[model samples]
Target chain A: MTGRTIVITSGKGGVGKTTTTANIGTGLAMRGHQVVVIDTDIGLRNLDVVMGLENRIVYDLVDIIEGKCKMHQGMIRDKNKLELFLIPAAQTRDKNCINPEQMKELCAKLEREFDYVLIDCPAGIEQGFKNAIAAAQEAILVTTPEVSAIRDADRVIGLLESEGLHRPRLIINRIRPGMVKRGDMMDKDDITELLAIDILGMVPADDRLIIATNQGVPVIYDKRAPSGLAFSRIAARIDGEDIPLMDLGPKNGIMDKVKEIMGINRGAYSNA
Target chain B: MRDLIRWVVTRKENTKNAARNRLQMALMRDRMDLSPDIINALKIDLLAVMSQYLVVGDEFQEFGIRRLDESVFLVSNIRVKELPRANAN
Candidate 1:
């Protein structure tokens, strides 16, 4: 089948590009589609560790491109599912080792076998970033609800559109509902306005995501985590489902409860 | 108690609002590939050059980024009442 290659990218680092890639890849696989997630961040490869397949990688993306190994030989299957696979990036090789043409060709080969190919792009808009975007037909930009990240995401969107990767959907990650409710942080609405892109999903700040990442088991496996559920909805959207976006109302703590009991309702929870 | 009452009444968050202001300025500056310093210098130079030809009003002489339709403009609107008539009565 000719698969859709969607690249997950963010212009800033630590904004959850890799996490989004891992979760969305896993979520799509959970939907019973054959999916492969590729890490294009060659030298600073962390997707392997994040996916918990670092020990299993004898060959990597560079190896496959350099003809040192077969395509499937370098692919590591996920322990959780048979439908998912990951092609890890080589740690020793730099960004210069792989070019856009090779990446495009590699993606073309993967397109024949998988239903979805999600590439984890590097942070900066350099060669690694270019290679990741080379063969992808669609894009998913990940950004946090901060000025720094949104500014960079806007620049990345312009660059992507210039390359004909039009209308890339956005995923605003690590959104603190409490801060947003207090009007102390940027919310989903503000971020979408800043970036001028269709929002895919809003993943709230969840501590369980940290444990899940460290344990090499994606939060999607937990099922109850807010961020996990948010990611699953994103995957479903990508799979052409019409799921409504979830309302990210902040969790009312003890103070809020007291205020509510006293009839001094905070505006954030007034609608509730 | 004044601060607490003000907070309760106005619901104003100073730091975040201030950040939004800074972000707006920075984003506009980045898009035009010119820093704030450059823009400020340009404004000063423009005012100096224009003062030689016309009298600029303090109230209408403005320099900042403004959004129009879908485009962001680095605009400078100067109100000139007319060159202080070189040979007026």
Candidate 2:
């Protein structure tokens, strides 16, 4: 099958790029698609731990690329999902170990096998980031509502465009609605206006996301988690499904409950 | 009562507005690959060139670099009163 390779990237660190990669990879797998997530972060690999497949990684991406092991041997099956797999990065190797040509060739091979190949890009605009994006046909840029993250994201967008990867979809993660309402944090409009990219999804700041990461289980499995629900919607959109974006405003009033029950709560219940 | 007292006592503007303003300026500079001073100089030079053909007004309705889709444009909306006289032989 000719699968699509998409790189999940955020130019800044700790903006949920790895977590987004894990969740979206799992979300696609849950939809019965054969998916493989490759962590191109090299020495700073964390996608395996986030996916809870760290123990299952007997062979890694470097091993397969170096001809030390077969492709299937390097792929580790998920603990719970049958269709999902992961190719963990080499813990001891640096980004200089692999080049863009190798990554392009590797992704071409992976695309022939899986239905979706998701690459978790490294944090900077260095060799690791270039290698991560070299193989992908599309990109999903992750950023927070903060100024620094947005600035870095804009720079990455320019770099991606210069490399012929245009119109990268955006995912704004870890947004705090209270802070936004208080005029302390940037809102979706403010960011979208600056970035000028189509928004793939917006994940609210959820405590359960951190807990799920700590437990080595993706937050997408948590039905009650808002961030989980957002990722699921993003996955559906990526899988060619038309789903409305979720509204993450305050839900404390009885009027909102009544409107939600009547199926008219300002598009908040559209996906629900 | 505490909220009201603090609201009256504090003169702080919303920090998000400040962030939005700064980001707008920064992104404009980045997309054009030029500093604000250079952009200002370029704008003046462009206006001077345009005034050679037409009677350009002193004020501009809109004049700035704008990004739309995949392109960055040095967009301007200057008031043109009339065209200059043509040379007669």
Candidate 3:
């Protein structure tokens, strides 16, 4: 079956590209779609740890491309989701070890079997970034509310357009709602107006995200976590479900909660 | 307590607004790959050329390179107050 290959990228580092890759991959798998996440970060491989499959990576992306092992040998199944898999990058090799042509060939092979091939792109506009986006049919740019990340994202968007990957959707991560309310941080509207891209989803800054990563788990499994719910909604949207954007404003009062319980109000979270 | 006083003093403009304004200006130049110096020089040259044929206003309503769809254009909207003398070379 033909599958969709999407590269989760951000020109600036530490903006949750890897985390978004892991969560969205797991989120899609939890919905019963067969998925594989390939980390193209090379020497700085961390998708394995994020997916909690670090100890199970016998063969890696380099081995699969170098013909040292079969594709299935390099694929590591997730601890919980059987349909989800991860192809970790080679920790010893440099980004120059692989090229765009090889990456394209590998993605072509994987697309024939899986429903989704999520490429975790490295941070930068260098060789690694080129190799990651070479074969992807779609792109999801991750960024924060800060200026530097947005600036870099704008540049990456221009570069992606030049490369013929048009209309890359945006995912704004680590948004602090309180700060947005206090007029201290940029909101989704401000960012979208400037970036001029379709918003895939908005994830709030949740402490649970850190705890989940510390436990070697993606936060999408934490039902009580707001950021986890955000990721699941994003996955649903990616799966062709028309989930409306969540209202990420401040929490409502007790009276509003009562109204929500009575079905008179849909509450602040799902007001569309 | 100190934050309250500062908030009251700077009530007209917040840091977020400052960021938005700065980002917009930066992106305008960045999207066209034009530096501030180049934009300033172009503005002066265009006004100078227009003044030879028409009584052009010193201030331009809009002047910059903007992207529309797949095409990029050097858009300029200068106010022409009046036309020059017909016999003037």
**lDDT for A194 (candidate 1):** 64
Winner by TM-score: 3
Q: How well does each candidate superpose onto the true structure, as a TM-score?
A: 0.81, 0.81, 0.83
lDDT for every model?
0.85, 0.88, 0.90
**What is the C-alpha lDDT profile of model 1 across A86-175, one tens digit per residue?**
999999989999898999999999999999999999999998889999999999999988888988998899889988899999999888
Instruction: Give the runs in model 3 whose Cα sits over 4 Å from its true position.
Output: A254-272, B1-8, B35-85
lDDT of 3 by residue, A1-272 (tens): 99999999999999999999999999999999999999999999999998888899899999999999999999998999999999999999999999999999999999999999999999999999999999999999999999999999999999999989999999999987768888888988999999999999999887888999999999999876778889999999999999888668656688767865775432334422
Clashing residue pairs, backbone N/CA/C < 3 A, model 1: none
Question: So what's the TM-score on candidate 2?
Answer: 0.81
Instruction: Provide the global lDDT of candidate 2 against the true structure.
Output: 0.88
Error of 1 at B8 (Å): 10
lDDT of 2 by residue, A206-232 (tens): 887899999899999988677888899
Q: Which parts of model 2 are misplaced by more than 4 Å?
A: A252-272, B1-12, B35-89
lDDT of 1 by residue, B11-72 (tens): 67545565566666666666677777887788778878888878786543677778765467
lDDT measured at residue A73 in model 2 versus the true structure, 0 to 100: 96
True contacts kept of 3: 0.75
After best superposition, candidate 2 residue A15: deviation in angstroms? 0.2
- Number of the top-ranking candidate, with lDDT as the measure: 3
TM for candidate 1 is 0.81
Whose TM-score is higher: candidate 1's or candidate 3's? 3
